[model samples]
Every structure is written in C-alpha cells, then in structure tokens.
Target chain A: MNIRIENLTKSYGDQKAVDSISFEVKTGEVLGFLGPNGAGKSTTMKMITHYLNIDAGNITIDGRSVRNTDMKKHIGYLPEHNPLYEDMPVIDYLRFVAELQGVDAVKLDDRVKDMVRLCGLNDEKHKKINELSKGYRQRVGLAQAMIHDPEILILDEPTTGLDPNQIVEIRELIRTLGNSKTVILSTHILPEVEATCDRILIINKGKIVADGTAETLRKTASGSQVLRVKIQAPSQDEVKESVSQLAGVALVEKVEGSENRLEIQSHVDQNVNEAIFRLCVDKNWVLTEMVPFETKLEDIFRDLTMN
Target chain B: MKTSNATWIIAKRELSAFFNSLVAYILLISFLGFTGFFTWLSGNGDVFFRKQADLKVFFMIANWTLFFFIPAVTMRLLAEEKRSGTIELLLTKNVSDRQMVLGKYLSAFLMVLIALAFTIPYYLSVSQLGNFDHGATLSGYLGLILLSSAYIGIGLFASSLTNNQIVAFLLALLLGICFQFIFGVLANGSTGWISELFNTLSLTSHFDSISRGVIDSKDVVYFLSITFLGIFLSEYIISKRK
Candidate 1:
C-alpha cells in the first residue's frame, strides 16, 4: 500500500488550494501531515484517496493510478470533520462501512465486531452516534475507517475535539495501527506527530516547506544551536566577550536577570558545551550550570509556517 | 461486492434512517390525513356523495397532494447528506456515483410506495360500495406510481443542487409544478409544434392517458424518460461536485 503523489495540483476557481506538491509513504510507515488551517493538508489527502479529482498531476497506489476503483478498496479515509450518520447506531454504522468496503459476507460481522473492540466502542455500540460524546464519536469514525482492514488510512485532524485522556487513548491506538498499516494523519498538534509518525511533512501555503524526522526538522529549521550558561563570573561584558571569542560561538548575549549568566549561540553542527567549560576554566569562573537548548517542535512549526 | 449490492446496502441504510426518525411518521400521517380528508370529507365530489364506483376523485386529490408530499420525502435525501458532510463518506466507498444516486432514489421512492400502499383501504372500501371499475382503478394506481416516480426524480435532482433542505423542497416543488401544470397551461394557449411539444412534456397529459385504462408504450416512455432524466441529472451533479 505505497502512496506516490507526483506534482499534484488542485484549484478552486482562481485560487490554487493545492499546488504542485509531491511525496510518498511506503507501507508500514506513518507519515504525519502538519499544516495550519487551510494549508491544503485535507486537499492532499482527498486527492490520494480519490475522493477529489486530481486536477493537474497524478497519484498512484502501489504503482497503479488512484482513478481505478480498485485503488479505493485498499484505502480508508476519515475526512475532516469526521462526518457520520447521526441517526445510525455505532454498530450499524460500522457494519454499513464494512459492507461498502466489500468485506466478504462471511467475515463482515466479525470484522465489524473487531473494529468495535479495537476502537473501544464496546460500551456504546448500541447507542446512536449523535448521543455519544465528541471523543466517542471520533472513535466511531476511526472504527468505520478501519472496518475493512484497509492497508492505508488517511485521517484529517482525527483528534481535533478529544479530551486529554481520549487523545492519549487514540494516540496509542494510532501507534499500534501503524505497526502494520500505512497511516497519513494530519493534525496541528505537534507532539502527536513526534509520538506516532516516522516522518513528518510540514506544508505551508500549499507547498512542502519541511519534510524529515522530528529531530531532523528541528535541526534544519533551527539553523543553529543555543547554549545557556550560568556562572559566578566577573561581569556581563567580560563573560560575553570571552564566550563570543570561542571558535564555534556565533553570538553571545548577557542574561538580563544576572550579570553572571550568558546566552551563547553556536554553529549548527557545533557543540559549544565543552568549549565553554574550557573557557570558563581558563577564565577561573566557577561554572555552576551549563545547559544546551533544544528547539521545541512548536517553535519549529511556527518558524516554518508563520513566515 | 457488486455495484448493485452496494446500491442495495446504501438504499437499506437510507430507508432505515428514514423509518427511525420522526419525519417518516409525520409524513405518512399527514399524507394519509390529507388524502383521506379530501377524498371522503371535503370538496363537492366527495366519494360518499358522488356515488361513483370509480376513484377518479381520489386520484385527482392524490395527484395534487403528492406534488407537495414527494418533495418532503426527497428534500433531505441528498441535501442533509451534504450538510452533514456524509456525502464525502458515501462517495469514498467502493460505490459509484450512479449507484449512490440510485440508492438514494430508491429509498425515497420506496417511502412513496409505502405511502401509496396505505390507500389500499380506500380502494377496498370503494370496491365494496358499488360495481367498481377495477380496471380503471388499477390503471389509476399505476399512473400515480409513475407520476410519483417522476416527481421523486425531480426532487432528487433538486436536492443535489443545494445543501439547504428548504431550498431543495422549493426547487423540487417549482420543477414539479412546471411539469405538472404550467406546461399544460402553456400548451392549451399555444398551437403548432410548440403546443405539441409542451403537451408531450406535461406530466398530467401522460398521467391522464394512463388513468384511462390504456397503457400506451408512448405514455409509459414519457414517464420513464422524465424519471431517467431527473436521476441522470442528479448523478451528473454529484459527480461534478466531486
């Protein structure tokens, strides 16, 4: 269930909702799609699932074009907003999805029951979807998406309205599901990607700005490493001057609170901790604390998208 | 699964949804109440006073009632699906666009048939009243079914045009009125090919011919063609929106 999207483009009237962007997700790999609102994440997922027409380019699943109906049989899609029949009971809705997915008649009931168990809907199986809480409704959406045991699952903002506990539950469920299926989940929650995805693609204004593992994206977007040092030094200017003269130190600034504290910026590939300690020893400054600052995913996301 | 099987599965789910809600009961009761009140309780040619064995009065009232009632059954078919965003889930299934349209069309059509079936008591009671024209009564029922089918098609097409149920209802009613009476009125005042064309397109003319106990293929074709055209247009609209 490999997905290959090549130069895909979609336009609504004069506005291009999805520009010519391309990526691939191999089987058993979890690809996280990260973007702000209206960043074309859902549009891309829709095109891959064949729910929307590919306007300018092509998408293929396992080397076959998605235009073929057979390609849809292997792909499961939970669209944005996670729409379900409000009047239908959870079990009935799952069964209906299974039937539509072309599950064999002999295995249909078992498959639906498995989804109910997997999605933790056993307690609410008989309740109408409208009666359930938002979190349970999301569970039902996920259950229906996997009823036929599809090889690929495309979920858009799957955990949008869930509470904290529900989010963790679903996060674990997605991680487990990713063990054997190719999953492309889109969300604004960065930690969800760090927790579940093997790779992350950050799209901004219909273009891929960053694609890599979480660590790589952090390093790439950060451009440099920061080191925070607190010591019993002589003065702010003296510490700044000594730290700035280090080989890999790019910039040095005084910490506002105390004259003894200095913030050091170094080259991207440099680890200034050892060099700073030696400088401190040479300057006879008793270094109380030296900590390297790692850029948070939130900062990276903001830096990538805000500009 | 086969496309037909998928269609049936979708149709069954739709029918179940209809029955589970209050809309179906409200529609059935109101439709029967209106038909019953008009046929036996109101109007100059009431069944009891007219003393006619035929159900011409019943058919006439039914023809008008369905013009409004059929839209109620169909207005939410596609419109609500679109509003609720379930149309995305439905289209992503292994189901084809045509299958999805037909599935919804059949469910609404079946509800109409059930409403029509409730009038059997009227038929039976009328049969016992006098020497009834059974052939004409049968033809009348056939005509109603065909006419209902045509209206259902139009209603489905209207539902696809917008996500607002009220708008869908009004659009279907507008189209139904045009085919049911406006065209006939225009035909009566015109002459030559224009009149003939309007006359042929009018639903009432074909319905009248079928109600006269003559099942002409041309009349049947006319009704079938309109029904097909409506469903076909709905399918096209759904695909285009995709």
Candidate 2:
C-alpha cells in the first residue's frame, strides 16, 4: 500500500511535535525516517497509524483516508519501546496479534510459524516475553507487527537496543522485507538508513529537512567532494610542494600512513587528480591510485542536522 | 487489523492474562471469603442471617468488598499497557480508542463476573436458611453487576489517566467511593440544585433501587450513563496519548 502524508501537523499546546510534515512511501519500497530524540519521529508514525489524532493534516492509504479502519489491514507497525505482556509466551503473543490483524484462522499456525522464523525467534519461541533479552523482545515485536504479512510496515526504531549481530540480522530482515513490501522505518541509526532504505526522510525539530536518495543527500551535503589518493612515500618538502601546487585542492591532509594514503578535498573536481598524478610521476614517485572520495552518510547527516 | 478484530484480540488476550495470573484467583477468594464471612459471622445464629435472607447482606458486604477488591482487579488494566509502553503498540495498530476501552472493560468485567460468581454459593446457602427471597437476591446481584461495571469503568478511566497501577487503583477507588456512598451522604446534608445533582450522581441510591428486585428505568439510566461517560472519558484520554 502506498502512503501519502500531506501537511501533517501535531502540536502539544504551544510546542509542535510534527510541524506540517509531509511525504510519501511508494509501494514495495523502504523509506527511512531519521531524526534525533524528540524530533517527532515517533509522533509522526503515531499520526500515520491514527493512534494520535492529527491536530492538522491529512493521511491517505491507497486513496482511502487514514481514518478508515479497514485500511489498517495494509499496514503493520513495530513501536520503539516494543511493549508486550511480560507473562505471555512469544508464540502465544504472536498468535493473539495475528488473530487481531484478521489472519485466517485456518492459517493462523502457519502464519505464526512464518513470523517466528522470519524474526529469528526460533530459539526462544516458547519463552515468556519478559524472560527474553532486549534484542529478543524487539524481534518478537517485529514478528507480531508483521505476522499478518501486511503490504506496508511502519517500524519505529526496529533496531534500537540490539547488539551488533542483532542489528545486522534485523537490517537483513528489513532489507528482505523491503524487496516485497513497502516499509517506512524510523530510526536514529544513520547507517541503517543507508543500508536498508531506498530513500530517506530526515526530520529535525518536527520538520522534514531532507527528502531524497542517499546520493542526492550526499551531493547536497556541505563536504560532498573528496579526493582519495595513494601516493609514493615522499619527503615533506616534495609532498607540501606538489599538494600546494594543485589549483583546486581545497585542503590537503595526510592520512596517517604506513600505507601511502592521502585525503584531499576540493570545492571543484577540476584537474586535481591529473595534477597530483603528474607531480608524483615527474618526481619519479610511485602513484598507486587517485580517485574521488565518496561522502560518508555520517557526514551528510551531521551537516544536515547541524544546518 | 480490522477494528472489531483488534478489539476482540485485545479482549481475549486480556482475559487470558487475567486467569493465567494469580491476581484473578486472589480477587475471587478474597472478595468471596471476606463478604461471605461478614454476612454469616455478623448474625447471632448460623441458620438465620440478621433476621432476613434479603440481600441487605449482599449489598452491605459488597459495598466494602468493592472498595478494596475492585481496585486490585482494575488497577492493571490500562496501567500495565502504559507501563510497558504497549499502549503505543495498541494505538499504532489502528485500534480506535473505544475498542481499546471496551476491550479492556470487557476483560475486567469478565474477571469481576468470575469473582462475583463465587458468591453464588452464598446465594444458594442463604436459600437453605429461612425462606430466602430469590427474586431480591437476583435483583441484588443485578444491582451489584451494574454497580461494579460502573465502578470498573471508572477504574478503567483512572487507569487510562496514569501509568502507575497503584495510582490508578487509588484514584478509581476514590472516584467510585465518592460516587457510591459519599455523594449520597453529602447530598443529603446539603439543599437545593447541588444537592439534587449529587443525589442523582450517587451509586448507592440507584443500587438501593435495584437491590429491592424492582428495576427502575431511572436507576438503569443512571448506571448506564456513568458507564458510558466513564468509557467516553477513557477513549478521549487514550486518544490524547502519544
């Protein structure tokens, strides 16, 4: 199901949680929602789910209003906190939610089995929710949210408390889900966005500050241009002389090297590489490689949020 | 999820949670034990209970029984959801506020009904005594069921108001007691419109009407109004939560 959020605004008294934010999630695509704590990420997800009524805005799912309860069949959600009944066993809990999501009774067992496997809860399938670790609990949350196999999954920080291994596992699962489902994943983990999201909506202080693919965001970032170079070990004078001679080299910085590395930046990607390669060869120094450095996701996030 | 489907799911889960835990059993045994013990022990003899088998015994005992017991049962309904952050989980599923309220209310009502059922032996045993008034006993139970439902709804509203179960329990009890007994007394001591309103607001007056085996439309209306109002507030409060 495709989701369209138009000028959605929610305010708590004088403080606005979601300030007229709007975006769309196409079918069979993953849209990463990035924001810091109190950036209204959870609030926005809540509004979309119709949990917290909109103070101002419109949300439609497949042309039907968000107010339509039947439209919920297309959406699944994993809340940030992963709240669950502590006394309940994993399978039982999923089964309960599955029935609620209107899964066919005859296929209930099969559905829950699929969910358990999909969420990697096979080891502790029968354990009480409170008995599991935070990561396992999160997995259960994901399993329940997706037990119905919804077309659109709205996951709120699906990997918040997991260890590295769990994070990777969940990321892979999310990526796999994205291939066949439309997912809007809200997270503070920027790398998760780059890893799993086809596109991103970065909100800051309740407003959509950036909306585009990773490449678009990187190109739009402040330090989007960088030069990756490998050069022969050189005398300090030669290095300083050749680096300074490049006309468009914004900054020449030595990458602490035992391995002939250098990091450079330029506002304009002119003939800087040619200049560096020529200087290395003219000095009879071995120039192994020279290429433009790709902008890191962290750099783009920092620049966007800071600005 | 379909709205009714979601509500039924929550209700079933809640119901199982109630029975699966020690709280339901504790509520049953304690409410039955205390009320039963008081009804029989207060009399001069075992065979006759304070001169009549009328539900004066049931009403009198239940009046205090609900004070402490209903809180224990209703405390965790919404407060647990709030504490565990499951309220967000429920909300994000697109289950409307009324569904949540009713789902939770139904579970608590069923649990209370279970607890109330244990008192059946009391009704049966009372019959063994002097010519027991089954009609009055049944009506007394009807009154209690109505009264307790209204109280439970209030408890649910209180539970919805905060994340602390203890706070919810106390607030519900305070509201229930104020509406049940204190409102009547206070209304009696005063005069005029304020008195009239408070008199109508009291739970005991309506309950007393039902306790007589005479179902008053006015009494039914009052109990139903409070139940609906409490649930409405519960829905509104939950809808406001983030």
Candidate 3:
C-alpha cells in the first residue's frame, strides 16, 4: 500500500506537535523517520495508523482516508514504547493480536507460528512477556505488529531499549520484511536508518528538514568535501602552500599545534585527491596518511535538528 | 471479521487477563467471604437466625459488597491499559471506540456475574431448609445484575477519565455512592418534584423496585438508562482523546 499525507497539522493547546507537513511512501519502500525528542515523529506515525485524529488536512492509504476503519486493517503500528500485556505469554499475546487483526480462525495457528518464527520468538514463545528480556519483548511487539501480514508497518523507536546484538537482529528482521512490505520506521539511531532504510526523512520541530536517500541527505548538508592529510615533512606551511595551489582545493589550513598535519577542503564537484597525491610526490614530501572525510548521517541530523 | 466479533475478541482477552491476574482471585475470595460471613454468620438477621427461605439479607449484603468490589474489578480495565500504554495498541486495532468500550464493559459485567453466581449456594442451602420464594430470589438476582451493570458502566467511565487505577477506583466509588444511597437520602429530606427527581435518579430506588419481584418497566428503564449513559459517556471520552 502507498501512503500519502497532505498538509497534516496537529496541535496540543498552544503548541503545534506536527506542523503542516506532507509526504508519501510508495509500496515496498522502507522510509526512515528521524527526529529529536518531541519533534512530532511519533505524532505523524500515530496519525498514519489512525491512532490519533488529524487536526487538519488528510492522510490516505491507497486513496482511502486513514480515518476509515478499512484502511487500518492494512496498516500495522508499533507505538513508541512497544507496549504489550506483560502478564500474557508471548504466543497468547501474538494470537490475541492476530485475532484483532482479523486473521481467520483456521489460519490463526499457522499465522501465529509464522510470526513467532519470523520474529525469532521460538524459544521465548511460551514465556510470559514480562519475564522475557527487553529484546525478546521487542520481538513480541514486532510479531504482533506483523501478525496479519499488513502491507504497511509503522514502528516508532522500535529499538529503543535493545542492546547492540539485539538491535542488529531487529534491523535484519526489518530489512527482510521490507522486501514484501512498505515499512516506515522512526528512530533516533542514525546507523539504523543508514543500514535499513531505502529513503530517509529528517523531521525537526514538526517540519521535514531533509528527505532523500541517506547519501543524498549527507551530500546536501555538507556540500563540500574535506580531507585530512598528515605528512612526515619538515613543516605544515610547506604542505599547505603546495595543496592550496591545486585548482580544485577550496581552502587549506594548518592543523593547530601540529606542524606535520594539514587540513584541506575541496569543492563539491572536484576530485582533489589525485592532485594532492601528485603534489606530494612532486614536492617529495613523505606522505604518511591521506584520509577523505565523508559527512556522516549524525552530522547531517545534528545540523538539521540543532538549528 | 464483523465489528461485534472484534468486540467479543477484545472481551475475551480482557476476561482472560482478569482471570489470570491476582486481582481476580483476591476479589472473588474477599467478595464471597465478606458476603457469606455477613449473610450466614453475622448479625441477628443472619440466615440461620431468620429461619426464612428467602435471601433478602444476602441480597442486601451483596449490594453493599458490590459497591466496592465492582469498582475494584473495573478500576484496571481501562486505566491500567492507558497507564501501561496498551490503549494505543487497542485503539489502533480495527475496532471502533464503541466496540472497545462495550468489550471492556462486558468483561467487567461478566466478572460480576461470576461473583454473583458463587452466592447461589446460599440460596440453595436456604431453599433446602424451607419453602423458598423463588420469584423474589429470581427478582433479587436480576436486580443485583442490573445494579452491577450500572456500577460497571460508571466504573468504566471513571477508568476512562484517568490513567491512575486508584483515582479511577475512588471516582467510581464516589459516583456509585451518590447514585446508590446519597440520592435516596437526599430524596427523603426534599419534597414534591425535587424529591421525585432525586428518587428517580437514585440507583437503590430502582434496585428496590426490581428486587420486590415486580419487574417494573420504569425501574428497568432507569437502570438501563444509567448503564447506557455511563457507557456512552465513556465512548465519547475515548473518541475525544483520539
């Protein structure tokens, strides 16, 4: 299913939680929603899943408004905290969710088994949810969300409490699910977005500040390339003088308190690495290290959100 | 699936949760124990002392017991879900707010029924001792069920108003007390139209009318209206929150 949100707005008292924002997610696409705390990421997901009413504008799944109950059947949501009945056994909880999702009684057993297997809850399936580790509990949450084979899944901070190993496990699970489903995952984890999302949307203060592939967002945020070169030479001034003269080099500066290090900034459209390498060889400066700096998603996120 | 099916599914889940938790056992034991002790063992009107085949004393004790017990059963129905954040999961399901409210309400009502069902042994033991007024017994059970239904509705509405279980319990109790006895007490002091209005609004008045083995349409309508009003207001609040 494809989701189209148009001019959506939600306000709590005098504060606007989600401003007039609009975006769309196509079928089989994994869209990552990134934002700081209280940036309306959860609010947007809630509106899409029809958990909260839209204050203004519209959200449609495959041309049907989200307010329609029929539309909810096709969308699955894991809320911010991944709430579950702690007293219920994992399988029982999954079955309960499946029943609510309208899974046929005849297929219920097989569907629940499939979810248990898919979410890697095979061992902990019989354990009460409260007794399971946080990682396993999150798996249960995921299982419930996908129990009915929803075409679209919306997960808010799905990896909030998981350890590194558990995070990777869930990331892989989400990636596998994304092959046949349209997945919208919201998280503050930059690596999760870079690892799983086909597209990224950075929302800050109820507005979309950046939207594109991770690479594109990074490039757009940092329009220029940076290179840090450390040379075993006589002085830093010599390295800066030679590198600064290159045609593509935008700026060159000496590393503070380091006579052997020079920082080079290059124009966005230029490949200055080769020029620097040639300059080092021609000037006979022993080049020890020349590393290109790629702007990370973290930098891009901070740049968009902090301002 | 049909909408009613969704409501039933939710109701089933809620009932299971109730039965599986410690609260269910605690409520059942304490309710049965308190009522049993009062009806069969305590006071001059105790069953053995009266030597009557009727359960008037039992019904009176039950009414008082349920005023507190029913709220305890219902306090966590919606409030705990809201506090634990499971309400989001519930509301986002393919179920409507009305279905959610009814599903939860029915679960609490069923629990009250089960508790009331346990008191049947009292009626049985009394019937064996002498000629029993079966009509009064039947009417008394109906009145208790209807009264419990009213409390369930009020409790559910209270639960929906807040996420704190204790607060919900107190709120429901306060509302139940007003409808149960306070209105009737006030009605006695007032006169004419005001007295009649208070009497009509008092839950005990309708309960008394039904307990007399005369199923008055006006009394039944009064209890049903209160039940509907409470459930309707709860649904309204849930929808407004969304």
| lDDT at B166, model 1 | 100
Where is model 1 more than 4 Å wrong at Cα?
A: A234-236
lDDT of 1: 0.89
Candidate 1 lDDT over residue span B1-242, tens digit each = 38789889888998888889988899899889988997898867888889887788888888898899999989998999999999999888888889999999999889989999999999999999898889989999999999899999999999999999999999999999899889999999899999999999888888887887888889888888888998999989888875
> Could you tell me which 10 consecutive residues in candidate 1 chain B have the lowest summed lDDT?
B43-52
Model 2 chain A scores worst on lDDT over the 10 consecutive residues at A232-241
C-alpha DockQ of every model: 0.85, 0.64, 0.86
Winner by DockQ? 3
lDDT of 3 by residue, A10-65 (tens): 99989999999999999878999999999999999999988899999999888989
Model 2 DockQ reads 0.64
Give lDDT: candidate 3, residue B109. 89
Q: Please give the CA lDDT of all the candidate structures.
A: 0.89, 0.82, 0.89
What's the TM-score of every candidate structure? 0.96, 0.92, 0.96
Candidate that beats the other on DockQ, 1 or 3, i.e. the better one: 3
